[model samples]
Structures are given as structure tokens and as C-alpha cells.
Target: MSDDHENQYHYTPTLWIGILFLVLFSISGILHILEALYTRLWFLLPTVVLANIGEIIGWSGRVWSSQNVFANTPFLIQICSTIIAPTPLLAANFVILGEVIRRLGQKYSRLSAKAYTFVFLACDIIALIVQAAGGGVASSADTDGKDPSSGGHIMLGGIVFQLVAISVYMLLATEFVLRYLKDRPVRPALVAAVGPRTLDTRMRLMLFGLGLSTLAIFIRSIYRVVELADGWDGRVISTERYFDWLDGGMITLATFTVNIFHPGLLLGRGNRWFGKHIDASGTSSRSGTFAEDATVVEPKRDNGPGAKV
Candidate 1:
């Protein structure tokens, strides 16, 4: 098991492809950072920005591999980066969903807002750690001139776990959406306009973006599970087209989703200051947190579209 350029990445990574993703992820990352700062959503800085960094590094490794395809270091770096890149973005999605539920319909949600954060983040962390450990193990084994199948198996297990977690999460999200629609829970009225538009439209666009991002990630996860199933040398891994579409393309779509339809548009200004009171017209002033769950309590007196306060 020499660490030569033999069949390591299966094919010479196209230089343009690597460069393209590098630029795309970089743009998304920059936009996300700017958006996070404007919205005071500091939380997104770590999650979305970190994922973008990983993708950037991974594709840079690919670009390096294009020049030196026989090198072990670049190949290992790319593989590891590509595998773990999406986990942080997935975590960001979880946070967004929790916030959406908190702002839109807390009573309709089955768990507290914090619960979704805790559970899904825990799952994402586990997947990330497992995959990272597998990469380390594989890199170590290659250095030691030992077989890397064990590490491949570990990576496959991690991907499978991720797939299961993502599926369960989607199911829960679907159930929540169903319950919300069936119950027709009253959404808190807009205390003030969200950027001169109604809250519903912004919220709807945010929801669509989240859904699109989640679906892209899920599709990528499934592809990864299959890619790593037959222990590194599988047909899936041998193909560049699959990785391009499933991995690079999917992440591109997911990352841009936030950039285009950032939740900040719906959150509006004064999102970080926790104790500010907003006076929704026709309603009493009430203190609202960044989540704005308090609006449902006091600030929004009338839930019906045309009801008198």
C-alpha cells in the first residue's frame, strides 16, 4: 500500500472543476459572513463560514492534486475536507429550523426550540467526529504501509449514520409542517414591517431556501453513503461525475440558498439586543428576544388577518 499517485483519487481531478468550486464556495462564504454581520447572526459565522472554509480547502487540495496527482497529502486533505464539510452547514440548518419554529409557531412544535438544537447538533457532531477519525486512521495506515480498508469502513459507517440522522430529521420537519398546516396555528402579527414587506412572504422564502438546502444536503449524504460503501475502491468513488454533481454541485446549491434567502431578511433589525420592546401597531408594547417568541404572547394581540385588536 504505497502512498504513490496510483489510483488514489481514481482520476486526475479537473483543474477547472476544482477552481470553480473554490470560487463558488468562497463567494458564498463571503456573502454569508457579510449577511451574518448585518443581521447580528453571529452564530452563522461559525457554521456556514466554517463549512465554506472546509470546501475551499478541499477544492484547493483538488487543484493541488491536479498538478501532483501522485501525492498522498493533497488527496487525503481533499477527501477529508469534502467528507466533513457539510456537517457544519447541516448544523446551521438545524438552528434555522428551530428559530423558524420558535418565531412562527412554538405551541405547534413538539419540542422546545433548544431541544432541536441540542439533538440535531449532537448527531451532526457525532458524524463529523466519526468521519474525521476515519480520515485520520486512513492517513495513519497509509503512512504505516498498512491496508486502509478499516478506515474506509469507519468512514462508511459515519456516512450511513449521517444519512439516517438526516432522514429522521426530514421526517420530523415534515410532521411539524403537517401539524402546522392542519392546525392552522395563528402566526404572530408583524410588529413592524420586515423590510417594507409582510412577514409571511419573507418567512415563506426563508422556508423555501431552508428546504432547498436541506434536500441538497440529504441528496449528497445519500451519495456519500453509496460512494464509500464498498470501501474506497467502489465504482462510485471511481467516478468523477458523481462527485461533481452530488458533492460539489449539491453544496453549491445549499450554500447559495442562504446567501439568496438569508433568514436575516425575516429576522429584521434589533435581532441581537434581547430586552428591546417593539410596539406592533394596534397592540401593546412587549419585550421580545432575538427569537421574537414573545410577540406571540403580548405584542401581537390579534392573530386573525382582519380581527380588531
Candidate 2:
């Protein structure tokens, strides 16, 4: 295709939508950084901040592309940033699950809480690397006037890998939910030792926010898989409407969702840094940091009647 022809429809990203996303991401990123600082949630700081930064850069690239669609620099920036942005957010989600399991009790989980965090985090890192590499290769191909199919295929591979990892995580989460429901009744001795335990309002909100963000990311991932299936020149890839709704809209919503219901707010200060350390005697240790022990304690709350911890 001629340069103009190639740039005509496929290159035309909506200017206003790009600006909107840029503003949204910028505001959200700043808020997340502020929250992280205020809450002292060091564990969550890096991922949340980095993910928001990626969104900001990605949307900035989109805005740049809207101005000059034929420019390779803006195009590459948008592709790389947008593809990699959600990976860290997904990592944050995985990390929080570990804390959730820790607060509830490791016995309720199939894998240890620490394992849940690291395993999925490793997968997320791999996915990020693969996608970044693919974007690099694709950009090089485009610049060199070579067919971009190889790079597109590589990107697709990364996306598929991410999808699989996310699917497994969803299954694991579902299993934990089922297990929690099935094992609702506390053992008499355990109750006697620790007093009655129940899920606090904050904890419930955290879980709900996590689920909503996960679903949003999941939907965005599925959309990417479909969009990239036909390679660079695919119908879906050329359609800005799909990009608006699936790519920009879904991710923006996910980021905002997490920001509004941030772990710092829900889990409370110092809670994210520590885990509930239970010994062989079934006694729980509320003291100790994550580096010192593999346990996480539930945030202290007043136990009301009929509450389930």
C-alpha cells in the first residue's frame, strides 16, 4: 500500500479519545503515587506507580499519533506502552491475592500465599518481556520496510501466554472462594484461641475491587487477542472503535477501579507489608514484616454479631 493509503484509515486514531485517555491516566497515576506514599504500602508502590506511568506514556503516545499518524516514533511508543502497561497492574492484582489468602488463612488456599504472589508475578514478568520484545521487533520491521508478520506473531504469542496465566489465576481465585464457602464453619478450638473472626467491610471491599479490576483486565486481554489475530492489517486492528472501547476504555476503567478502591485504603496502613504468621501449634503471630515471615494478619476490626472472618 502507498504511504498515504496505509496511513489513511489505519493510522487515524481519534484525537479527543486520545486526549481523554491521556488526562485520565495522568490524574490516576498521580493519585496512585500519592496514595502509595501516604499509606506506606511499599510492596504495592512500584507496580501500581509503574503501571500508571505506562498508561500515561501510552496515552500520550496515542495523542501524539492522533496529531501525526504517519510518525513511527509515536506509533511505537503507543504500541509498546499500551501492551506492557497492564502487565504490572495484573502483577499488583496477583500480589494482593497473596495478602488476601494470608489474612483469611493459608489452609483455605491451594497454594501458600507467598507462592500465589511469586508464581503469578513470574508469569507476568515473562509476559511483559515477551510483549516488549515483540513490540521492538515489530517496530524494527516496520521501520525497515519488512513484512511485520513475524513481529505480529510474536506479539500474539505473548498475548496468548498472558491469557493463559490470567485464566489460571482466575481458576485459582475461584477455587479459593469455593473453599472459603465450604469451610465457613470455624473449628471450636480455633475460635476459642483467636476469638471470632469475620471478613471486615474493608476486606470485603478490597476483594470486590480486585475482582472487578481482574474482570476488566480479562476483557481487555481477550479483545487484544482478537484484534491481533489477523495481524497488523486485520479488520479489528484497523478499527478505532474497538480500540476505544476495548483497549482504552477497559484499561482506563480498570486503573480507576483499583485507584478508587486501593489496597492501601481497604487493607489499611501496615497491613500490606505483613502477613499472618501461624505456627505449628495453630497460634497466629500478628507481629513481623513480610521479610521476616511468610504470614499476613488480617487488619484488626471490631467483631460484630454474625460476622465471618
RMSD of each: 5.8, 5.3
Off by over 4 Å in 1: 184-199, 269-309
- CA lDDT for candidate 2: 0.77
Per-residue error for 39 in candidate 2, Å, reads 0.7
TM-score of each: 0.85, 0.85
Model 1 C-alpha lDDT per residue in residues 147-180, reported as the tens digit of each score: 8778878887888898898898888777766655
Q: Could you give candidate 2's per-residue lDDT for residues 150-232 as a string of tens digits?
A: 77788888989999999999998877765564553223333323343456778779888999999999999999899778667
**How does model 1 fare in lDDT?**
0.78
lDDT of each: 0.78, 0.77
Clashes of each: 1, 11
The TM-score measured for candidate 1 stands at 0.85
